[model samples]
Target: MIEALAPVFAGPLDFARHWLELAEAPEPLPRRPIALSTLLEEEVQRPLMARHEARYPGGDRRAALSMWTQYYCAQYLLSHLGAWLLLGRMLPFRPDDIAVLVLEDGTPDGFRLPHLGAVAEGPVDLEPLIREHLAPLFQSLQRHHRIAPRVLWTNAAVRVSAALNLARQQPDVPPLRLLEAEALLAKPCWRDGSPNPLHGTQSRVEVEGEMVLRRRVCCLRYMLPGIAGCGATCPIKEGQSAKPLPLLKSA
Candidate 1:
């Protein structure tokens, strides 16, 4: 099954490779999966918790803390799972195939709740499944940092319209606006401050027999002060052009 699904998740390898390069590690990669797990556990998870504690002292915001922890953990888990899948790690079952266990009716031995169903089924699409399940976790992270997820718009018009309509219902929430409204340009950046060779690469698209130049954009979220929600920095041309773009503008 793992071998069969390899083609479906070929992108994971690229994702892992990008992260590895950002971390400034050598090529060929390490074969020990346990070492990667330990690295995440110690470096990622532990430090994230410490940061959370430092940000919110005395644990008053337990719910927010839980959400942040879940968000970071879910990201770490999904990334590792992706890397594992790419590495052809022999596992008893595919990560997405495993059903989440839900206790219906139970006591120490057993009990019954009259109005409950079976465990929630996992999504057929692993990426979306991971994203949806981890939504609450990400929300928690945002809450702790006093940030909210920006509803991003893709090229898909239907999704954009739906998102716009939804945003209208929440008065407190910001209104739907074009990505251009923020005057943001997405530019790829190495997370670890390393230079990316592909930086500022331009692609030309012919529209009406006229060639229009547009550079590739990479959007990412981070916490910033005075921002109600998590701030998205759409880096265009590296730090040379820092622009604020709508979080949910068309991509």
Candidate 2:
């Protein structure tokens, strides 16, 4: 029976492989969350700071390192949750539905969402499931100082609604299309500062003084150029220019 299910389990194995590659160190293998966290801190996070300090002589490397460590920790927890989901373990909460609350002291407070419940082999009710399972996780985070007071929900209903409205104004635009476009615009803006102009349908402007242009292309640009609405001018257009763009470049 396990052999019969091997094909079905291949997807999880593949995902695990990809994650392990990103982790890169021998220490974090076999998917242990605590071990992965430690490896990430030592291998990835610490190295990032050391490189940053070496390259850019000034600025608070310590503060940047601290922030990145917190972010990486959150990401590690989320990745562990994903691995557990792949293994069929029922999670105590849904990280997506709940928001990450950040306190003034830079700790995570808790999460908030509609109630949740475990469903049997029939139809599922997501609302109650979120309340029962996810809420407790949020409460635990709050109690443990793993989260802060400010909440950051994974579901972007408000942003999605706004996007839908914008899409409605334009004829023949799909919801997925709008989302891809928005993500492309938002990612670089948050990560390295300045939105990737290619994602924005609007015309580009040359801002005076201290203008930073971080040349980044969205994944959709590589995977689904046709859906991205770039037409012949798609970033993935064949020949020399089709090559993927780098995420960062120094001014």
Candidate 3:
């Protein structure tokens, strides 16, 4: 199946090559398959959380979920956003068409796409990826754990911002695609005019001689026992941190 996506993964987009899998057979997968949508179920989430908590005993449940969101968004969105920004393409990002591969420790390893969905002939907006994919997933996580939707959106946005940063640094990226990437960050609303959760989740700041990302929302990783926070990129400042709770409903 990966052969069908050779063109999409070509050039600078190959940086996200490991974030998604287009396998010819399922027999070789290193982890068990869990439908991304099924993550909403308590029965499914319980054991997954067990394996995850086992890895870091005594971590706060909400913090553990937040940490998981960071890992998931970073890995999955790299491939999704990379393809969108670099190639005018949309991968099989619909939750129904993808599966999360869970490692023995219950961290999501990567996504399995049924196939490379399609490539647009011209510009492609982010509505489909957001409304069709992230929104539902965020809703599920929010309903399950009562964490704010913004936390997950911000987690996802950090990855999108990172992908944009990479795209900007690429020497071979198309000029029009760069414009599209800028437009994505600039747009304050989705196609339906709803507030875009990703609009301002990250920004570039000069640190030393190089530009680095600063996140707008902390991932609550600091709440976990012994887990290091995001360090320089974290929005939280000294002596002012709080645990994440659902402040607003999921969009």
Per-residue error for 240 in candidate 1, Å, reads 6.3
Q: Compose the digit string of candidate 3's lDDT tens values, residues 19-72.
A: 567645554456776778787677888788777866555556777887888788
Report lDDT per candidate.
0.29, 0.31, 0.72
Clashing pairs in 3: none
Q: Which model is ahead, 2 or 3, in terms of lDDT?
A: 3
lDDT of 1 by residue, 35-92 (tens): 2222223343344444444443232233334334333333333333332222222222
Error (Å) of candidate 1 at residue 173 is 37
Candidate 2: segments with Cα more than 4 A from true spot: 1-121, 146-150, 154-251
Q: Tell me the lDDT of candidate 3.
A: 0.72
TM-score of each: 0.25, 0.24, 0.82
Candidate 2, residues 1-251, lDDT tens digits: the string is 12311321243233322222122223322223222222223343344345433332333333233233334334323332222222222223444433333323333323222232232343222232323433344344344333331221221112222333434454444444445434533443423454432233332223455333222221132322111222332223431144433333234
* Counted clashes in each candidate structure: 10, 19, 0
Rank the candidate models, highest lDDT first.
3, 2, 1
Any idea what lDDT model 2 has? Answer: 0.31
Q: Mark the regions of model 3 whose C-alpha exceeds 4 Å error after superposition.
A: 1-16, 203-212, 238-251
Which whole-number lDDT from 0 to 100 does residue 117 have in model 1?
20
Mark the regions of model 1 whose C-alpha exceeds 4 Å error after superposition.
9-132, 151-251
Winner on lDDT between 1 and 3 is 3
Worst window of 10 by summed lDDT in candidate 2: 149-158
What TM-score does model 2 achieve against the real structure?
A: 0.24
